[model samples]
Target: MTALSERFTTARQEGRTTGRTAAVRARVLAYVGLTKPRIIELLLVTTVPAMMLAARGWPSFSLLLATLVGGTLAAGAANVFNCYFDRDIDRLMQRTQKRPLVTGEVTPRAALVFGFVLTVSSIALLAATTTLLAAALAAAAIFYYAVLYTMVFKRHTRRSTEWGGVPGAAPVLIGWAAVTGSLDWPAVVVFAVVFCWQMPHFWALALRFKDDYARADVPMLPVVTTALSVGRQSVAWAWATVAVSLLLWPVATGYGIGLGYTIPAILLGGWFVVEAHRLLARIKRGGDMKPMQLFHVSISYLALLMVAIVVDAIV
Candidate 1:
């Protein structure tokens, strides 16, 4: 009887422990989902290439992994923190109402704790694996997105989208820091490419979701101007993007990114400008497809352009 009772107690304890473990796992997945990992994965596509280029070839696989892990954690923390900051506004929109914070699956206090923990942990990890500069840049990115963009610019003016470029451009900076342990013209070129690329891409999304943004009283560029004006701005930026990317050839000391890369970059630029023009035309006619097309092309352009950069570095 004593042995049987002891066995029964052991089984009950195991069951209780299993139940708690399951609950903890569920909660952790929910938090990870809150980070929008898909978006961060795309951002990493930009991050790794920049790091590789800055290193002038392959970098330490171990350091690269650490940087990537730290970057994902930092980016995740930024997203989660942003969700918490915008919880009230998120509840007001269809696009965001299902967020863990908005849906009460994760309480605001819990989210704040989670985000802070991730942010601190990420910076610590980066510092441990790389230089303090990498950690600092990562922290700055978190600050720019979570505090500057999410808390301030997002609530203030229509130009908020433009100001939010800081964080968008940061991955390149982080990439450069991770590899070179410093910043330079090549890093600046990469940062400019990504920064300029975001204007049109995000503004198009803003255009499509104007009603949602307006409903939330979020001050995005599209909400303040006609679609045509935004398109014109996009085209102007696209032109600038093409120009900056072309300049990168000389900057990287012709790192194998010659006419082979140049031709496609120019072609892509022309297409972007044309799309921007089409967006302008559509707006004049009170339509919308062009902006959307330009948005999609912009994504392709960035991916291809980075591929060319990597190829150039390799050759």
Candidate 2:
């Protein structure tokens, strides 16, 4: 009987230990989720290629590491604040209902404090390891996204996503500044390209989530406008995005970007526009536009375009 009781006690202790470990792991993941790491990945995708183009090849290892780390932290900070501010709307949206804050996995106060810490750390990291100009751009991006876009325009304007592209494109400039220590025409052109790209990319996503936006009272274009109208605007922005991408071919001459970049830019831009027009055509036929089609392709377009830039610079 004594031996049996000791066995039972040991089993209980092991179960309690396992439960505690699982709880700690859940909390850690919840905190990481608040940072919105996937968005940080997309932002960094633009950063490294810009750095490569700015260097005309691979930049110094230390500089690349510093820029990427700083950019990720800065972008993460902005996203955390956005999540905190939008937690209410997020709870309403089916897509965001599982977010850490909405799920109660992380407290609002904890998320807010985490955002502030990331903001300060990212800025200091950038300033210490890269040029002050790069640090300033990172700070600007954090402020623009967390304050301007989230707090003000997102709730008020139908064009919130459009204007929000400014900060979205800032990583390109920040990456360029990190490498060159100053802004230049290539950086500006890349910025413009990203700015134009955001419209179709995000508008497509907004279209996909129109019902959610409406439920949440967010004034996204798709929520406020007809599907056809959204498709038309996406097509128009797709044209502008392609046009701006082509402009990089001419502007990037001094940076060793030539036919290598130009050819892929034209091809990819054409494919992107074709997809945008497809959405418009679908909408006109009174069929479901399947905006996620364009949304996914846009990610590919941007990734390929950046890769072309890197290849052109290196070759």
Candidate 3:
């Protein structure tokens, strides 16, 4: 009986330990999900390459690590705030219904406090590791996305995507500032490349979920305009994005980027424009354009272009 009691007690203790471990793991995953790690990955893709070009080679490992860490925290904070405010609409949309807040994995109060902590910590990290300018840019990005884009333009205007591009593109500027401690025309041109890219990239996504936006009463371009109008505007923005990308070749001459960068820019930009035109043509044919086709391609286009920039600078 004594041996049996000891065995029973050990079994119960192990069961309790296992249950506690599982609960802790679940809570950690829930908090990480609130950060939107995938979006943070996309933002960091633009950031590190811009740092490479700004340095005209590999930046110090410490600087690269610091910038990426700070940028990810800032971008994540912005996304967390966005999720907090949009939780209601998010529950109504198929794509977002499973987000932490909507699914009861995280509470609004917790998300808000998490966002606040991330915001303050990110700014302090950038200021300490990089420059005041980089920190300020990161702070501005958080504010612009959280306040201007989420609270104001997204609900009120059809042109919100266009204006929201500003904060999305700010990562390039932040990356450059981290290296140079300042901004210039070249940095602005690189910033414009990202600025222009956002329109078509997001419009394609918006087209895919027009019904979601309509249900949410959000005024995404596709929600408020004809398919033809969305297609045409996407093509126009694609052209503008390609033009700005090429401008980087000339503008970045001082950074030692040469024809190697130019060739890839033209080729990739041409392919992107072709995809945009195809999207338009599909729309004109009275058929579905499968906007995710363009949406996925746009991500690859940006990643490849950033790679070209880094390679050109090094070569």
Rank ordering of all candidates by TM-score, starting from the highest: 2, 3, 1
Better of 1 and 2 by TM-score: 2
**Candidate 1 residues 24-60, lDDT tens each?**
9988778987798977976887887788778877789
Question: What is the Cα-based lDDT of residue 172 in candidate 2?
Answer: 99
Q: List the residue pairs that clash in candidate 1.
A: none
Query: Candidate 3, residue 47: CA error in Å?
Result: 0.9
Deviation from native of the Cα of residue 223 in model 2, angstroms: 1.4
lDDT of 2 by residue, 238-287 (tens): 99998988888778898898999999999999999999999999999986
Candidates ranked by lDDT:
2, 3, 1
Write down the TM-score of every candidate.
0.90, 0.97, 0.97
Clashes of each: 0, 0, 0
Candidate 3 or 2, higher TM-score: 2
In model 3, state the lDDT of residue 190: 81
Q: Tell me the deviation in Å of residue 257 in model 3.
A: 0.9
